[model samples]
Target: MYTNSVLQTDYPWTKTPLVASAPMLNIAMAPLAVSVSAAGGLGFLAGGFDVSALESNLEEAVHLIKQSSAPIQETYASTAVLPIGVGFLNWGADLPKSIAAIEKYRPCAAWLFGPRSIPDDLRPWVEQVRAVTEGKTKIWVQVGTVAEAVAVAEALNPDVLVVQGADAGGHGLAQSASVITLVPEVKDVLTTRQVKNDIPLLAAGGIVDGRGMAASLALGASGVAMGTRFLASSEAKIARGYQDEVLRVSDGGSNTSRSKVYDRARGILSWPVQYDGRGVINKSYIDSAEGGMSDEENRALYKEELKKGDLGWGPNGRLTTYAGTGVGLVKTKLPAGEIITNMIQEAKAILQQLKA
Candidate 1:
């Protein structure tokens, strides 16, 4: 029975800093959620890619939050935080099951991605989420375009709008602007419409450090939604091989690129053509690109890679490693709480220096 969280609304994050960990399928799990919450940030459970484990994950998130540090413990007594949240992909997949499961958890907010158009295309899902949350839980919508963000911000009672840039990991709009170029445009539109107080803008993509967070704020984003950074968190439920790949490619993050390589390998060709994602440019992707291997061969390679367990990643590894261009900032595999706290501290220092 937690009260309202300081972060659950459009309040000034001047002292508390609003940082959120983006939900990554097969990666963001209970420990990750708890750690983020304990750090006084947003912890969103990954509710997309399938709903089979939704209930268990949400339950585990609660369990971990309860067992976490004092900030989260106080959330249960006061209204400073709701402990955890959940996110879902609404573009190519069905959302009913995911929605149903998360509705019971009563998360602080529900994040929805792939809103082709807002209020109109997203209303039904929003309505369902409202009904389940009794309109108490806030709505956080993610969009890749300024047009989509403006429309959604204008028509809905959304609490937050996540502007995902083309540099993001996982599935993202194939044709989208870079974070630096796109965030300000979205901010201008929202400010012009006078919706800044109602809908806070969060910049997502290639950002994994305090410098990026500070830069986003300077560009008009209220916070940063980081996915790749959390993928390196010690609590992330990713394989060791996956985590290593994330760290290995950290040389200014030039080792990754946007492509549909994983979707093709996994037979997930249903995503709209406009949506593609960034993945680590591994040996398999290079080989498959030159028609040197068949789909069957690629699938076989993926299977073998999975069989090698957590330590099995290299040139021959067939795992789908999604990462951002800013992977270079991810220098270590630290705890999620440590990452959030350090990022906030670093941002504060940078902002202070600029003020000086």
Candidate 2:
């Protein structure tokens, strides 16, 4: 069976039942990524559709690592790879630019998602990143289905597989199972196929607290990656209104829904058709789905709300509030480091209690 030992070996500095922060666009920037790493959890900075900011972001992360306390420095002293990882949306990413950034920054891992085609589109990225980083950088491919997972494993043989469920926030497959079923199914398929390498699986989607983390481990995940949970982190580069909405919302099952509505309103139409994003429901969604508002009209109003700054979010607010089904569990805005450490402690305690 899969175990945390695989992850501990890959990421020597991390604690057991590894916790990672999902790379959210414009939010999981240098500060949040570095802070998560310092606390012994892997953190990923979102490379987004555009990679122009990647080098500058990595530079800032390097500076932060250098200025970190001795204990944090010691955790990273043994490896040449940067402790934090960088994630990319492959559908719209400029491969050459992304490769250039990875070549220079040499992040520990590259979390890839939303490719136009499986294995075919992801091949060059995997080969080139490995070539440039001399295998120092591990490739992490995200998939929402068992077929996609098996295809990637057979072809790219990625170092890690991030199994994202339908409950996840931001971009993912519109039709996908929850982690409760997806993780084990992927594991079973990969095991049956006898993929040459034992690629570690990291479960993502709807997981907000230590309870979710422990449950994922029980379901055979090597680690858990949380996006919504970190949206409430103090270091997340999110607007006050957006962050406040994330904390204020509850019952993510009913409050959040997956659709391309926000992307259309924001004029970001580059994602693959199969992919959609999960976010808190608001006036914008209501006006479009129920009130029969046109995309053009919604876009216009969204732009107007953007100018309102912190007032643009909430039930009545029109701006997008991308979050997960577990948004209700994320009630506090703690430091990213504290969030990681606390979750790890709580997950361990819960797992121990279950063992007894």
Candidate 3:
């Protein structure tokens, strides 16, 4: 009967790591999930955006889990118990398609992000997953603001609520509060409302190292979710040049901005209106307006940039590099497990120093 910092005495996540990899749109695939889970933290295979081959990805998640070097391989069988987590975008996910895949595989958790509807679609989706999962799957939602958190909490009980700040890489809330401000604000709202249970809060954005994780814990979060940090991981499916840029721009987080310049350049016309994409600025950024470049301009830029293929870095890099303010901390492309393990060790060291 020893008290372990990583073990939860609450309703969800009995035992977990201090860090979980944030689910990126097309990048949070099977390999990354299995690797992070095997390393003792939670990881989710992205359930939306490029999900036409979801079944194959789910199958691969199982295969990787079974093949993992960790002893968790035995605990997580090749059954429908869902050894790994899968996430779907609330704004644009094909619910029935996502549900069908989840029903077939039955991951341990389902993450819903980039909200478009709640109380109606969210409630039904949660109920359906519960009915099929026998209430075994944990429901996790990512909200950009305190209001969103309170609204979701009132609608249906969730296992985890992610408070993502504005400094985060990739698409997030239009005008978001920082993690320091947002997580506490959301927690206080939930507490004051006197919800049935004190939902767990996981802080995200600009959390690149153990110091960030430790700080989040001190600020009253159950854990921290890292997106930009993991983008540099060997398992993450991103262009090598993008990873290089992540390391190159460590101290200059201000260089990263929120804009649809890259999205338009790539011909992505319809991202959710309430959200915006964040990443390192490229050629498209300078000439682009606040609303983004015109289709004709972006098309011309895309055609020119596409010719570079893999060498998409430096001053003129035009590819969509979804990242956060912590882009500079990403130094190397290590394996997913190594990243988690090192982060845990670093957290322990930082916490010990604070205690002393």
- How high is each candidate's TM-score? 0.89, 0.97, 0.92
Model 2, residue pairs in steric clash: none
Tens digits of per-residue lDDT for model 3 on 32-101?
A: 8877777777888887754577889999988887788554475555334755678877666777777788
The predicted structure with the larger lDDT, 1 or 2, is: 2
- Each model's RMSD to truth, in Å? 3.7, 1.4, 2.8
Cα lDDT of model 2 by residue, 1-356, tens digit: 32556677777777767788988999999999988888888889999888889999999998898887454466556666788899998887899999999988889899998899865569999999999999989999999999999888998989889999988998899999999999999999899889845678889998888899888888888889999999999899999999999989999899998888989999898888998899999988988888999999999999999999999999999899999899988899999888888888898898789889
lDDT at position 32, candidate 2: 91
Task: Rank candidates by TM-score, best first.
Answer: 2, 3, 1
lDDT of each: 0.76, 0.88, 0.76
Runs off by more than 4 Å, candidate 3: 1-17, 78-80, 119-121, 290-293
Tens-place lDDT digits, model 1, residues 89-135: 76644667766775677777788886555543478878888887776
Off by over 4 Å in 1: 1-15, 77-82, 92-94, 115-121, 195-198, 291-296
- The clash tally of candidate 1 reads 3
> Poorest 10 consecutive residues of model 3 by lDDT?
1-10
